[model samples]
Target chain A: MKQRTRFSRTVVGGAALSLMLSLSGCGAGSDAADGDTIHVLVYGDAANKVEKELVATFNETSKVKAVLDTIPGADYQAKLQTIINSKQAPDVFFNWGGGSIKPFVDAGLLLPLDPFIAKDPGLKAKFLPSVFNSAVVDGTSYGIPMRGTQPVLLFNNGKVLKDAGVEPPETWGDLLAAVEALKADGVTPIALGGGDRWPTLMWFEYLYDRIAGPELFRKALDGDREAWASPDSRKALGKIKELVDAGAFGTNYDSVKFTDQGSPTLLATGKAAFELMGSWEYSTQQDAHPDFAKSDLGYSAFPSVEGGKGDRANLVGNTNNFYSVLKKTKHPQAVAEFLKLMYSDQFVKAQLGIGNLPTTTNTERFLDTAASPEFAKFQYDMVKAAPAFQLSWDQAYPQSAATPMYQALQQFFNGSMDEDAFIEAMRALPAS
Target chain B: MTRTATPSAADGTFDKADSPGIGAGRPGFLWAAPAAVFFALFAIVPLIMVAVLSFARWDGLSSPEFAGLDNWKLLFDDPVMIKSLWLSVLLTVLGVLVQTPLSILLGVWAAGHQRNRAVLSAIYFVPMLLSVAAVSVLWRAVLDPNFGVPAQATWLFGDGNLFGTQAGAIGVLVFVSTWQFTPLHTLIYQGAARAVPQVLYQAAQIDGAGTVRQFVHITLPQLRNSIITSMILMVVGGLTTFDTVLILTQGGPGSDTTISAYYMYQKAFKSFDYGSASAIALLLVLVSTLISLIVVRLSGYDKMRSTMEGL
Candidate 1:
């Protein structure tokens, strides 16, 4: 018995030792190869496909190899946080260039790219000012502009509007008229997904920004201005109440899951007249309802509010989703080289072909100037017009404050709290 | 070194010396040394670390600040945390109250002269076999407002939105949890019921006792230990329910079904507030421990053990 026990113990110990040695060997091997590879982490299914193709293209031409790690949108933050905490952050990772990256930048986890930008005169001149400015923190650029997405008024087919005998709304009064027309025809005018707080907040933001103007919006977020007491903010709240009173949104909107709800489909099928959604909705709408072409879609900013300084062109957007390099990258030069490749003409064309809005100076050249005449017109107008661009409210504030702000907005939309309560809650948000 | 040699008897057997080493034997401590070391390293060390972290303020990135009782104090003031804890307790109590008796009944029914017992058990146990993610996705589709089974049912029978209210959502969650867990407890109870002596049943039959009487008197008493074991398991499992709730509601429509475990995850991972998360975890552990002790004592496990030993 003793002999058998000793033998078994020796066998177990030997197995453990071998396992440890193998683990150590794998670690060492990875460390040795880390010099050659530029690990990039990104989020979203669409971004994953694009990134994979980009990486493959880069590997074919460049001396350094590129690896793309695609994390799910929901899990990306947690995964990135873990990697950062472990000091095993990837060479390049997706970042929301505003306050989301502020924490990482402040911790010195991100590599500042002003020095790189200064050396590359082509890159310095090619990037959009808004995109470049979004990445700059305390006079240093820490991220590269990837894509830009902004909210636009998306409307359904001619059936709903034709039945209502109303043209596309260009002003707040026109919109109200359209809503009234739709109500007369016994059709829901606006299809809003209050279940997803973000969508509800988007409408709130558009109204609030239009009412309060860009300066007050920024001031309110910074706590320099109180939203609860502001008459403009209250007016914005009243607009939401107006929509609710008009029965613009569906019944039991609070309980519906955002992804499962068929608001996009409703628009495609002409069940709903219009939807206020981000530009990404184009892709999702096309995917869900293939019959609905890009031509069928009309793009407009939120209708101009009466007696408000905000115009139709005063857009609310941010170059929030961008990419940055980690300071601890073994191959910073290689990573930078890869990033340069991403900004190349071929990559830009590929990104643009997929309907992504590139933040480069060459955006106009790649856009569907012929196919999407309305979008082309909007782009041209934007270039000629110098309307103030406001950053997304959630992205502008620190995450600690921003998360609860979203929850509060959700609560407000769900009818648990009024607009005054929401503004007060926003006022009470802790400073980061 | 007072060495003394004891003389043997006339039988020629040498007398062994009763030295301290011989009396005690070479200390038995060495035999238990490895296991103790391993237990201390793996279990005790981690527990100590968690306990220490519970008192400190951390963001899971920078070095943790020693905030004394700040995290614990915050727990009392945090409405979300308190609500989540209450929700978890409510879920646990409801799961036990509904599931335990239902599982026992199913176990008893399956153990009777039922020919399709194996097939029925297999069908019932399928949900338990599925991954939580798979189950959640399947249920999400079934509960979808536009095209799901529940929605379809509601449209056919009653209202069009079965999951449109907080109470309805919670009911669906509870139902799903109970359905998934009942099979496991049923199987456990069935096995225990199978182990009860056939002679007891025969003796009851000879006494003119009916089938119901046999079950109530003979079978139930025999399966008491199993029932207690399964109930404890169910309570513990229910207390930490997260994945299904996360996939379904994400503590939605105003934090309706936000259990303590989900709250902990949202704080520690989503919001990166590790300090409060750790405190919540510590509180969860304490509550679970207290409930478990009370349950075990009330179930008369010790008495059962003594009786079994006496038998």
Candidate 2:
């Protein structure tokens, strides 16, 4: 027994030693630093090929070669926060350009782009002023628009609409009527990605903008707690509840996600009538079901609310993806050259090919050559003529407020929160 | 010079002269040093760091600043955190109640069916082999209202919406967790059952004890250690249920299924409130430890320890 115990102990000790040695080897080393290579990190997606192609183009003649790195979409923010403070921080990084980059800017980890803009007036002048302003924190630009504007649009399946013998809703009343008609015809009125929580946010965004106007959100964004408690805000909340009760979004919206292609699939397969999504839905659908996208896909602005204060053409979404320079970058000149390429005609044409409506001044000239010229013209005209384009609430608020804000909106939509409780929660959001 | 020898050495009990020079009748503290160092580096250091961080204000990007009980104060008042904790505790309790007996029965049946044991075990363990992400996504697809089993059921019944309601979400989560985790507990119980001496069971049967009686008196006592251990592990897992909930509901359908760990993740990663997240981590640890201790005590773990020592 003693000898057997000793043998087992020796075996255990040997295993432990081997485990320790193997684990030591598992510690990941940092990426090799290239003296003449500047790293560019972006959110990985179908768009990654474009970034890689651009990087290759830049590396052809540039002194400092641009290396593209991508973190998967869901893990991007968390991974960026982890690496941003370390020696592995990228020279340039992609961001949503608003509250997404505000924390980094506050920490002084990001470099302001004012000097770069001053050096080259075309860099600042080439992009749309409103779109470019999203990246400007406290009147100081910190990011350059890298992708096209993504204004939220009411996407509908033409086949589903035609099957129901109903036209796409032109006003809020028409939407309610269409909801009834679609329900009568045995189809869901709207396919909402409520499981993602952020998709449910679109309803609140469009409704608030239409009912109370942009100033209501502007005041709320500016930290006026009363803005959320106003009668107009309550009215908007009531309208959303009304829609929910009317089965406009159906009962299963809470279980479907845009991220998972759940709600979009419903629309594409004609199980649902409409989906309020960003313009990227066009590309997404075009990829998933080319046949449906070609013949059945239709896009329009959100229906106007009766007696609403906001403009009919008002839009809401991300202005564009931006490339912000980290203060620790070793190649500022290379980064500047990269930013300049965002406005070049090639950039405009490449983005249009992917169904993205670039906010560049040169974008209009290339719209005729777009993958879907009609859709591109519609988004461009809506953005250009809009009196206000309220940024998504989650993007407009600080990062800390995002989870709670989404929770509040979701709770209100699901009837877990009353108007008062929702107002209270909004007021309780972290100021910083 | 006076020669002094330790009791162990002087007693000639160990035959020190015949023993090896290294670790000769002595506890090898040096051999344990490596394990101690590893534990200190990985577990102790992180635990201490979390304790310290709970009292500071941090936003991941910014430098941490001292916050003097503010995180704790906020934790007490935070409705979401409170709800999450309650849900976590509830889930843990339910998991224990639901999984223990079911696993034990399955484990015993598998052990008895010696010829088909391999096939039976394999069938039961398939869910355990699946990754949590895969399990969640699979269940999500299976329960989807459009084309899933629930939708198919609607043809027989009318509008089966299982994953859409709060109770239904919780029920599905619990059911899925059981389906995936019962295999693990069954394997554990099977090992413990196998470890039980054949002589004891033969004696029980010779005394005219039935299978049910044998299990109650012999198997139950034999499996005491495993039952307590598995219960604690499953309970801790329930408290920290994140992956399943994250992929399944994302704490959705109005935050009904949001467990504490998921809330902590959101607090740290999404909100960037590392300080508060650390506080939550510490709180969850305390809760888990306290519950484990209670389980150990109530399960007569101390009594078993004394009994084993006497043997």
Candidate 3:
């Protein structure tokens, strides 16, 4: 009996040791006590340069080493998702401020910023209410909006318009007339890339918001009301169809890749007359074509429908694209401090100098009037307008509903399906 | 005769005390312990987990609930899933039927010609050397209507765009896939064909058989195993093909080119419907397994193996 007991004890001890070793191996903690290193994940070339400058400044002042991993805007989400799923999420990473962050939040991945915000008086007052509200979910803020983008009509050169003998459109009718005039001049009226489903959906969402207004759009997206039967939705769909029918897009638009189509090569070469794109295109076009002048570029809000309820200046976008600290991170306090440094006056000045729109309300004061005249005018117009800001429809909707809707819109624009069919298909999407 | 020898006695003296511990009983369990533990950890455990999860609803992160047959039912009812499964089958059949014969012919052509065979084989195998992403991107550009070689050629000939219609897109996809995969099959078939005896061809020639007739009679029969093996591999690969279609069309023009694997990916990652995705995955596994079994039987591999052993 004594011998048997000793053997059993030995076996039990072996099992215990193995279990302990396995558990320890599974949850090995990183030794980051040096306090000299900081990691940041940022998006876009412009943002990357600005981040590097800020990090350099921080390193010099604080005697710490800062590293920034910059991912492209298109690939950032997928890469971030991989990191999060691997449970090796970065210390600081880019996060969109609305339902886009909900997946991470639901996964218990993001650090709530309420305590940090309460401690920092500068952050509390500096952020706009709309921008700050985008970060809140279930009464907890998960991200700090670093930059905001409002949807604006990006047009080609004034020379092209003058050659076509058309004015910048102020109303829906004028927009149609401009397209016709450009078409007559042997120019592709609109440089739309329907190949990427998302870009095509932008037109749909813009028209939908303009027709139905924010409240109804929100209600429809939330599944509280039906969107398919709405006359406003129908009219919006019809407008997209009309655009398609008007030879606004290039031949073989469906087969064209978005990168090839959206690139400034065609527009710069004068193959296409106009492109309804976002404000980011300004920097992109300038980079692509060295000869492109800021004076040659034109920016405006989407023209208002003649009898529509939505106003011309009803901005459809969000203060998305920001960074949030991971809840699973070891150094929460350090991460919050990094975020504070990122949004400081010096960082804001650097960002604005690089022509990026900062989310902080006070950041506008740092803008140099002499440096960027276009950005200065945009800032003034933004404040004076008091425009109704609507969230991006695809961004606001659940991914299940959103992806198919975007795809359907692409199909509709490709002339494979009609507006009514597209709306019906969207309505028929499975709710989960 | 055994009684006369008494084998144990002839060898040495037998001890009754050691008899119980000797090779009289079943083998020790320790021999199988490692294998059991490995299988339990790697295969059995995960399979059990997947099977359990398949019957329940979970979003990969959240708590699971008993879903019963809801997911499986959704699998049948979902039109996109059904269409994708049909497309996958079509791709498999097409890949096997078209690529196998072409590979065999190339393999036969290059087997005996030693002088230029090295250069020829290298040229044929170039496509297989490329990564899937690289191949997809290369083909996408080649098939691109606005900026591709094909489009430019079509324009020169006054035929318009090559990727404008559904048939054109599918044609390019099929052509690219076959071009990329035929090289791998050719190498496999060539190695097997080379192993066949030259004596057999001489015998066929003595019987007044020409090159084509000898190939049909002796060469094909000898290479039946290799052809079947390559066919099976190609079929399996075709059923799960995703990268080329994704890079080229992204299931655009209303999900025209969406296959089973891409459909599952879109559901699980894009749509965040893990339960439905899991259901589709389970169904795919069952279908693939059944098809593999049928193919093995139809290829007469078991009969061929028995015949070879008898010879």
Give one clash count per candidate, in the order shown.
0, 0, 0
- DockQ of candidate 2 is 0.39
Candidate 1 residue-pair clash tally: 0
Q: Which ten residues in a row have the lowest lDDT in candidate 3 chain A?
A: A379-388
Off by over 4 Å in 1: A1-30, A33-39, A48-72, A85-87, A121-124, A148-152, A155-158, A176-188, A294-299, A317-320, A327-343, A369-386, B1-43, B155-164, B206-211, B305-311
Each prediction's whole-model lDDT (CA): 0.71, 0.84, 0.69
TM-score, per-candidate, Cα-based: 0.85, 0.91, 0.81
Q: What is the C-alpha RMSD of each candidate to the true structure, in Å?
A: 8.3, 5.4, 9.4
- For residues B136-241, what per-residue lDDT tens digits would candidate 1 score against the true structure? 7777767655455644576452443444456766777888888788888888888878877787888889999998899899878878778787887878898889
What clash pairs does model 2 have?
A: none
Quick one: ranking by lDDT, best first?
2, 1, 3
Instruction: For candidate 1, give the lDDT of residue B192.
Output: 75
- lDDT (Cα, 0-100) at A403 in candidate 2: 81
Pick the TM-score winner: 2
Off by over 4 Å in 2: A1-35, B1-27, B155-160, B197-209, B305-311
**Cα lDDT for residue B279, model 1?**
85
Which one is best on DockQ? 2
- Model 3 agreement with the true structure over B1-311: per-residue lDDT tens digits: 12222333322333433343444443355634544565687677876676676678765545678899988887888777898888889878877888988999999877876788889788889999998778877876666654567546864523323354566666667788899999988988888788887878887788899988998888888888788778778877887788877777677556767778888777777766667777777777778878887988998754444212222
Candidate 3: which pairs clash? none
